[model samples]
Target: MFNRLRCGSGLIQETVPRFGFGPGQENLFVHKFTFSTSKRLDRDKSLIYNSQNKPLPRLDPSVVGTGNRKRAQPVIQPSEKFNYSVRKALELIYYEEESRIPTLFPAGLKLSRYLKSRTLPLEIDLVSRAVLYNTRQSKLEKIHLQRWAPVDFDKNCAFSYLVARTPAEYAVLVTIFREISRLEPNFKPRTLFDHGSGLCTGYWAANTVFGKLTEMFCVDPSTDMNDLATNIIQQGVQNVPLPKGINFRLKAPKTISLKYDLCLSAYTLMEVKGSLERLDIVHSLWERLEEGGCMVLVEQGTNAGFQIISEARDFLLRLCEADERDGIVDNEKKGEVLAPCPHNHPCPRYHHDTVPCNFSVKYSLFDIPYFSTEDVHNDLFSYIVIKKGRREGFRFPRLVEEPLKTKNNFYCRLCTGSGMLQEVMCNKKHKDLFHLSKFLHWGDEMPVHLEYTDGKEKPRPVIDRSERSMSSGEHFRDSKKEKDFKEEKDSKEEKDSKEEKDSKEEKDSIVKNGI
Candidate 1:
């Protein structure tokens, strides 16, 4: 469902000056380097895990399609802690090297210092103004306009890029990976392909979400990026020396010839120059999918990202529909959306009044090893998950945002049944439904049935457990069982006492009468 506020705006984990430039996985901006270790930036302004107070929109019973599909998906969340020894060591090394280089090697330090001083907001404005106003959009016309490049591709820059983006990028990847794992439990891909691997965020996501990827083929045009990915991943996982199972291709092939169980293109389509050109990339990526294979496309969560996801969704659906219409696939469904959509209808966000779908999750540097500040950008992303072959499974409607609460109701924004974002409200009267809403966090599949209505969705939400997996009803049931047992035992004891008293009275009367 579209939140008007969200419709206007929102993810790049990249800080200031690191723009997505070049081709392949190079579209994701390089991560910024920082020297400070503060967890909160402007602590008073930033909310620490604001999600706690975050209000989700409501789900109206009247608007909802009815059924009890509300069976919850198994809880999938990232572990609270993971091994970060490698990162910690690297950070210390960088700090020491950074301090020594400025004094001994004066020239490079000037460039580093200048880059470090840049902020994200300032860069965005400068780039937009230059592209839109100064260049008269000429830069945009050329397809790959150079916004700005801070430094040459080198080991140090690459290391800093990956480290700086790690916290935010990991959060984004974890969410996508978790959902993918849930969607395809039986899907254990023997081979994987990563397009625009960008320090292999896809690999990290895949490894975390699904324990072992049989083999990984990572392709990115930048040699520096490929090296950085190999070094960082191997160091973190102790797979140093570039394991035989993982291959990093530093050059872009004229075409992608390899087929794999899973393929990923993360935040790279924007570099393709033209809309149709980007679609060509999408088509090529789709062609590489083996039967029953899956493809995941990701983009930054800004308006541009959402727009691209919308456009891509349209193209993929059209391709599937055309395949079906042309009888090309021998009477099988050619493709289907796996996540963030319950149905394969045209994107609801494409409509002018509707907002594009995106997912948001929070993270902090404190959660990981050797970072300057606790503050990190929240993970907001517009993504699409597609599978090659048709599957028989439940595609639950996703909760679009945090559900909103009110005095009498909760308005839940959900994307379901062909990608329609609708608001459904559940009042205090619907105890079970309302209880389920509390268990829901952002980006969850509503475990219940939701219907489409012709009426205008009521805007008023006029609305989790504290990490416990138990639902509200489960607690009630547990208490009810205890109550029922006590009542049954008390009734049995009362009956036994009455019988004993009656028998005693009868015996006494008989003895007194001397019958």
Candidate 2:
């Protein structure tokens, strides 16, 4: 069915990661590979394999060799022209049952045959053309799709070519934007610079929410993707219900000298030329922002600040340990013990688990528009706003007591204890979990209390008990229950402490006695 391009595929099947070079560029190619699970073969099934070695059924001519019976090629290249063979292939797949379509190659051949006379070297070119057309026609429906805007949607094209490729980045961008919007309304930015704008998703997002004349600049190193992105943006601008005023420029970062009000880098920093080189690039881009300008960065967000590190770890754990390369494993004697990826894929000799991680570390080091002025160690994807210079005094926004019931449980972020909460309680009871300033100082409303840590000389004042609001409760029964709970917790702590102390003493005695 996928052979026909008439079969409709869901986001799960359609969203494979495809890679390509620029148009008209030599070595330009796109690869589509799908990965799915298969049930174990029933070796005991007597009919499945004859002990005497019976030959399998002959290949169906309609399925395999019929494509050789090519009709007359149209004058125009099927891929070059907007209509004709590509459309036919698309209709074929879009109309078929999801289960009937077996592989993308069949659908690819149908269009490739129509365009084979065009002399294009790669079959992927036709596929790319076909999928690009599909994306333009398909509307993203999920909130993550809407939020990530152009980038996630753009990567959705990759779905046809890649395995385990799911672009959920849009949700992150939208969450940050929505939070910032709700936090500071008057701080609407007028100009934005996206450092590594793969497919210009941020531009679409900005256009979707702000709708003002926000000058947008998209930068990327890949010439072909940049071209595709440029086309996508143009297409979006021409058709998308955009706000009345908006200007867009797709150019290299080095060329753009105009200072912007905001800058964003989504999944681009990790793919930069090098580490120090990427740092320089970020600095150069940062300089092109006016005072009070902010920068937003998004990436894979891993432990080591480099992309290769995370990729290596993921490969070792996922592919090496599993000993399964899907279908892309290289079987010929290449001196390597195991095929790195699935059988015939075009990635390096490794299993790719994620985009790189450079966007996380270096971006956090620099000062941007406004947020924290201290050293930041972000674990997962982080939201940062760096301001240029000191401005007028400002009042902090009131902390919203976020209700646990309202938050999505899909994502849970991590950080070392030194960074923030050690084991942050994101449970429904802790609604205001992220409001850092709430527990800062003891005040009139809060009671002064003393708490002690082990190996300390004296007890420390963790909280002032007198300032606690529940201290003045009029109901004796409720107050008694509260006091009893506290006492029970204290008793448990004492018992644990005694056990620890006794264990330590016993160890010391044993050592002294030379056990």
Candidate 3:
């Protein structure tokens, strides 16, 4: 109660309005609030959508066991705040059947309203399970379904909104952060914009990424969904307030009125239905990005998801050419593929059903207490990031396959700009390169030079002594240094608390000895 300042109605206007513009600042920290009174029909059902850009922290070399095999684990962990929401979801749908009252949010005034508006149907439990399965399977098979409004809004909001949808978005945002951080380690976003801001999953993800956001805006179309999102988002704010400045709107903006550091269209493009309309909306959102800003789009890791990402990728490539001819921009700044593709070339795996242009990253799976089996999750997803400016980096390509040992050398499948899909080998004679190749992973970029065109043979890409590969080594060293610093700090703190530790030990001895 003390942490949050309630402002659902006219509370903001009545407050002291401590919002201020810092010295020598014009547009910095400008806080404004406006509500759209206009309503809409045909918005019964709510499908909320959800970002982040943090590079995955380097793995400790010591983590590998004596056998030299390293176990890859999810680099991200859900915050305690997020876990609290998950637990709340568990109570709502499951415990509600037993007539259990929610104990977490004591401010049940709004929640009770939703509960009293209608009875929780007997079929809610079954329906929630069926709906979850349908959504999960739809993603796997690339099947599209038109969402009809839920009969029981509470159950839907609990299972679909808080449990399933929010968590899925969080996973995508985690990977986005990791990949983005790897691309630009110093990326500190001032503003984050979420399209289809269902429940502000992107907001939560942004916290796990940048840890600081100056301002954030979320827009959704469904009133029911918006209400639920607002309620939950506000509740989340009670514990952990992220992005110091935050706002949520009920309606979508007609156009991009303000530029953003990061713009996300996660699992949202599919809602547009029409390819052209989706592309047009994506283009508009892209335009809203400030120069050097990043735009990330996440879709279900199905064939349809792959296709939509492919179309968006091609659209980005042609944007510069079209702009040059139509005079859309003065210099025609080209968009660059930030991740999932080493270069902006046609996806060779486009038609390959078995191997589509996608990468699967795993996240920690969450299970509800009693219904763990039914709520089992697969954290796999397909996503792509496109940058507004040139993606200046390497010339070779990225490995889509894990490096494996052959009869004499190490080899992997690489997705290259000119070479397309090709097998690259690291000869054993090149001991340095070979040893480095051993560490080459499925999502890592390959450093060797290879042919862009299959028609001719090109010289092997040369890796100089001061090549970019050393960045991984540098990251390892930096991580080690940080670990050492933390250990030293912890040791000093422990030594300083020696008296307290001895006192605790003495008390423990007395208790154990039954004194």
* Candidate with maximal TM-score: 1
- For candidate 3, write residues 1-515 as lDDT tens digits: 01113467432212111121223432232112211111111210111100011111122333332233234534344667766665564355345522332332232334333322221121344445555676668464322232211333344443344543455567778877777886777677879888877667787788777886778888766666655555455443344443357877765577777899999887667556466777887887787898888898887655556667878888877886687678876552667788878777676656321344556554443444433333334444567888887665554467765555555676555676662555555666756566666666666665555423432444444444444445558879978999999999999998879978899999999999995
Sort by TM-score, best first: 1, 3, 2
lDDT scores of the candidates, listed in order? 0.60, 0.35, 0.58
Clash totals in order: 40, 51, 9
Give me candidate 3's TM-score against the actual structure.
0.58
* Best model number under lDDT: 1
- TM-scores, all candidates, are 0.62, 0.36, 0.58
Residue pairs clashing in model 3 are: 48-198, 52-177, 53-177, 54-177, 55-181, 55-182, 418-452, 419-452, 449-461
**Global lDDT of model 2:** 0.35
The parts of candidate 1 lying over 4 Å away from their true place are 1-85, 88-157, 236-241, 254-257, 366-377, 451-515
Alpha carbon lDDT at 103, candidate 3: 33
lDDT for predicted candidate 3 compared with the true structure: 0.58
For candidate 3, which ten residues in a row score worst on lDDT?
Answer: 44-53
